[model samples]
Target: MDFLSTYKGGLLVISHDLPLLDESITSVLAVEHGTLEPFRGNYSYFLAERERRREQRIRERKHQDEKIARLEEGIRRFKGKTEKMAKRARSWETRVEKLKAQRTEISRRGRQVAVRFPQPPPSGRTPIKAQGLAKAFGQNVVFVDVDVDIDRGERMIIMGLNGAGKTTLLRILAGVEHADIGEVELGHQVSLGYYAQEHEQIRAGDSVLDHMRTVSALPDRELRSILGHFLLADKVDQDAGTLSGGEKTKLALAQVAVGAHNVLLLDEPTNNLDPQAKEALLDALEQYEGTLILVSHDTDFVEELAPDRAILMPDGATAYFDESMLDLVALA
Candidate 1:
C-alpha cells in the first residue's frame, strides 16, 4: 500500500482477488508484455482489459520479434563493447535487477492468503498403525490403550494444551522414543521426516547445504534446486549454528520438502514463522502428497488443511473424534 503513489503514477497490482483490488484501486493497467491496455475502472474492467491486451499482444509480438531480430543483428555486427553502449547496458541491467528484487518481494506476498488452495491427497494407503499402544511418564499416565491407524495422504492432527504429551506421541511415531506398552506398526515403504520444536536433531557445526547433502545424502546439484523452493538458496553457504530460529525451522522443513519422506511428523511447524511464513508452511502442507501427523495451535491452518482425524488429549483420557476448530473450541 505504501508503494502506491500519493500523486498520479498508476499502481500495478498483481493479485488473484478482484474484489480486494476493486475496493482499493480506481484504474487498472492490463499488460500481457508486448502491449498494454488501460482500463478506466477497477478489477472488473481489468478482466475485459486483459482480454483486449492479449489480442493486442498477439499483434504486437510480431513487430516486437522483428525489432529484436534487427537489434540482435546490430549486436552481432558491433562485435565488442563500446564505452557508451557498456554504460547504457549497465544502467539497464541495474534497473532490471531493482525491478526483479521488487517482483520477488511482491511474489512472496502473493503466496499469503486467507483462503487456501484445496490440494487433494491420494487414496486410502496406511502408513502407521498402532494397537494397544501405551505410554506413562513417572506416575502420570499419558494414555493406556491408544489404538490408531495413519494412512497415506491422511492428515492427522494431535492437539492438546501445554504439557499434554503431544511431543511424546510424535516421538513415539518417529521411532525417536520408545512407546512404553504396545505394538506399533510402520508400513514397509514409509520414510519418516521429522521437524522437532527443539531442532536438536540436525547437526549445528555444518553449513546448511552440507547438512542437507550429508543428512539426506543428496547430490550438490539436487541440493541447490531443492533448497531454492524453501527460500534457502542464498542461506545455503551460511552455517547452521548461525541461523535464527525461523531460519533453522525453514531449513528443517526444506530438508523434508526435498527428501523422500512419505510420513511427516511435525511438532509446532509454525512456531517460529511470521503470518506470511505461516501461510507458506500451510501451502507446503496442503500441496504435500504424504501422510501428515502434526501438532499445532493454529486454528486457521488446522481448518484449511482439515484433519481426517483429530486426537485430543486434555486432563487425562484420550478423546478420538472428528472435530473442526470451532467445534473443539466450543467443547473447550
Candidate 2:
C-alpha cells in the first residue's frame, strides 16, 4: 500500500479494497445502474458526494410527484364540465404523462442485499478432526505435523502470514486438497460446504440460474428467489463468466447457502465484497447454526465473527482466540 501510494506513475486500478483506493487513487468511476458516475476525488469523497446527490434527487422526485398529483386532480375536475374544459383536461393529461416520463431515476444499487443461511441440520459434537497433517510441493514444505479438532457449532479462524499455509491447511481440512500425510475424520451426520477463495465451484459456461440449479434441486421459482436475495435477480439468465469478481463471489456464497450443510469452510470469503455486501454476509454467518472454519485478512470481519479459537499456520499451533491475534491478521 505504501509503495503504490507513493509511486509516480499512471495506473488504472479495479479493486474492492477501500483503503487502497483512498491511499493510491485520486479519482473514482463508480458504476451504478450500468452507468459511470465519475468523481474527481478518492473513495471517501465519492461516498459523501453520492449520498448528497441521492438526497437531492429524492427531493426533486417528491416535488415532481406532487405537481403531477395536482395536475391530475385538475384533470379530474375538468373532465365532465364544458367541452372547452374537457379539451383542456386532455391537454393537462398529456403534460402529466410527459412529467412522469421525465421523473429522475434514482439508482436501486442502494437496496440492501439480503443474504440469509437457513438453519442446517445438527451435527455431532465434533464436526471434524485432523491428525498428523503435512503437505509440501517438491522441496517446498507448506506445513507439517498439523492437527485440528473443530466443534460442531464453533467459529474457528486460521491465521498466518502470506505463504504460511493458511489456505493450504483449510483446503486440506475441506478435503479439496490432499495433505501429504494426515488423517481427517468427520463426526456423525456432518455435511460440509466449502467456499473457495477463487470461486472454483461456479462454472464459466453456466448462467447464474444454472449454477444455482446445480447446488439444489429446488423448483426454478424458488432458486430464482434465492438468487434475488443476493441481488442477482436480473442476472439469472446472464452467463456467469461475464460477471464481475464481486458478483461471482456472491454466487459462490449463494450456492453454499442452498447446500444445507452443518459445517462451513470459508476461504477468504470476504474478498471482492463491497462494504454493504460484507455486512450482510457477516449478519447471515452470525445467525447460522453451523460450524464455521474461516480464512480471512479482514480484521473487522474477524472481530465480528468472534471465533472460539485460532490455528496459527506453518507450525500449526492452536490457541484460544484473543485481541492479540488480530495483529497477525493484518500481516496476512
Candidate 3:
C-alpha cells in the first residue's frame, strides 16, 4: 500500500483486499450489474455512497408506486359514473400509465455469494494418518519427520512462514503430490476433496461446465445448479482459463464441494475471495461435518474456523491450537 500510494504512475488496482484499497486508492471504478460507474473516493467511500444511492432510489420507487396505485383506485371508482366522471377516470389512467413508464429501476443491493458445502458421508474416527512424511526440492528441504493424525469431523490448520512447505504438505495429503519418504493412509469410508490455491486442477481450453463434469458425474442440469450457487451459472460456456482470480477461486471451491468427500485438504482457500464470499465460505465450513486440513495465510479465516489442532511446518510440530498460534498464522 505504501509503495502504491507513493508511485507516480497511473495506478489501476483490481483487488478484493479492502485494507489495501482503503490505504492506497484515491478513487473507485465499480462495475456493478453490467454497468461501469466511477466514484471519486476510496473503496469505503464508494460503499457508503453506493448504499445511499440505492436507498434514495428505493424511496423514490416506493413513492412512485403509491402514486400509481392511488390513480388506479380513482380510475376504478370514477369510470362507472357520468361522462365527465368517465373523462376524469381516463385522465387518471393516463397519469398512472405515464408514472409507471417514468419509474426508474432501483439498483439492487449486492447479493451475498452462496457457498454451502454438502454434508459428507460418515468416516471412521481417525480418518487420516500420515507417518514420517518428508519432502524437498533439490537442496532445499521443505520438512522432515512429519506425522499427522486427523480425526473425523476435526478441523486442523497448517501454519508456517512463506516457503515453509504448508502448501506442499497439503498437496501431499491430498495425494496430488508424493512425499519424499512417508505414507498417508485414509481410514474406512474416507474420501478426499482438495482445493488447490493455484487452481492447477482447472483445465485450460475447457468451458466452466466442462470442469464441473470432470469433478462430478452428476447430470448437466445438476452441475449447472451447483455452479449457480457459486455465481458461475452464467459463465458455464466461458473458458475456464479466462476467468478472473476470484472466479477461479470460486470454481476451485465449487469443485471441492461437489465431491461429497469426508475429508478436505484446502490450501489458501480464501485467497481471492471478496469479503462477503469469504464470510459465506467461513459459514459453510463451520457447518461442514467433515475432517479438514487447511493451509492458509488468511488470519481472520484461520481464527474463525477455529481448528481443533495445528501443525507447524518445517519442523512439523503438532500442538493443540491456542491463541498464541494465531501470531504464526498472521506471519504466514
Candidate 4:
C-alpha cells in the first residue's frame, strides 16, 4: 500500500525488498482481533511483536477451550430461556473472533518461516558447446568467430581488457542477450542462476519480508533467519528503497541460497561489498562444489576463485589458459 502511495517523480517511499526495506521503512503496522494498530519499530520489533501475538493466540485458545467445556455443562443443565446459553455463546464467539484475527494477522504480516530457493533441474556435466560465436555493432566487431566447450564442474573465467566482450559472451550464455552468430548448447540438466552487478532481477518497491515471500515459499521464521545472515534481521520491516549498495547486493545473494542449483553465473558479484564481506563470499565460493563462471574486476578474487584457468580476449581473438590470468596479461 505504501508503494502505491507516491509523491512526485518516481521516488518510492516503501518496499518489500529485503535490502531496500533495511534502507527505508521507519514504522510497522500490527493488527490484533479486528483492531488495527501501527508500530513505529524496525525489524527487531516486528519479530518480537509477532511472537507476542502468537503467544497471545495460544493463550486465547486455551481460554476458549476451557470456556467451551464449562458452557457445554451449563447448556446441558440449564434451559435456553435462562440466557446462560446465549451469554456463553456471545462470549465464546467474541473470543473466537479474536483468535481468527490472530491467524489472519500472522498470515498478513509477511512472516515466511521457511526460505527455499528454486532448484532448477541439475544441468549434469556432459559438456556445454559454444560453436562459432560472434557479434558486432555495424562494422565495429565486438567479437569474431569463437568456439569453446565448458566441461562439467568447470570453474571458468572470461578474462579480457575493458571493451573486449567478456560481458557480451556471458550475456549470450545466460540467455539475457543474444549473439548475432553461433550457438551455445548446454550439457544435460544444466541449471543456472546469474547475478549481475546491476541487480536487475529485483523489482522496485518491495520490502525485505515482501521480497522473501515473493521468491520464497518458506515460513516467516526461516525468512527472518536468512535475512539475518545478510544483516537485514534488524531491518526486515524497513523498505527496500532505503538500502545501501552493499546491503542490496547481500540481499540479492541471499535469494540464491534458498535453493540449490548447478551453475552459478556471476558478473562482478562483489561490486559494492566491503573487504570482510568479499572475503566471506570468497570463502563460500572456494567451498562451493559446483561450476562457476565469474566476471570480476577484483584481481585477487578472480585469481583465487578461477585460478589455473582463464580465457583472455583481445580484438577479435581469444586465448585460453590453463594458468593465471595475470601471468598471461604480464606476458602480453
CA lDDT, every model vs. true structure: 0.68, 0.91, 0.90, 0.66
TM-score on alpha carbons, each prediction:
0.60, 0.88, 0.86, 0.58
Model 3 segments beyond 4 Å from truth? 5-10, 67-101
Predictions: Cα RMSD each: 11.2, 2.7, 2.9, 13.0
Position 259, candidate 1: lDDT: 61
lDDT tens readout by residue for model 2, 162-219: 8999888888888889999988998999999999988888888889999999989999
TM-score between model 3 and native: 0.86
User: Which 10-residue window in model 3 sums to the lowest lDDT?
Assistant: 104-113
Number of the top lDDT candidate: 2
lDDT per residue, candidate 1, 1-332, as tens digits? 33453546655676533334667688876544344656888887777766665567566655655555555555455435887776665565555455444431111112232212223333347778887777888998877677668777878888777776788878888888888997668876777778887877567788999878765676888787667766667888998888877778778877766665777899988766655677777877777777888888766667777777777753323344444453552232
Question: Candidate 1: deviation at residue 322, Å?
Answer: 5.5
Quote the positional error of residue 235 for candidate 1 in Å. Answer: 1.7
Q: How do the residues 1-332 of candidate 4 rate in per-residue lDDT, one tens digit apiece?
A: 23433423443243333333343455665444466666666545765777787778777777766666665555555535557767766665566555555443233433222223333455766546687888887897888777656766667777677777777888778888878999888887776767776877666688877877876798989888888866679868767767787777877777766546677777777777755577777877776666777777666666666543566654434445444455543332
User: Could you tally the backbone clashes for each prediction?
Assistant: 0, 0, 0, 32
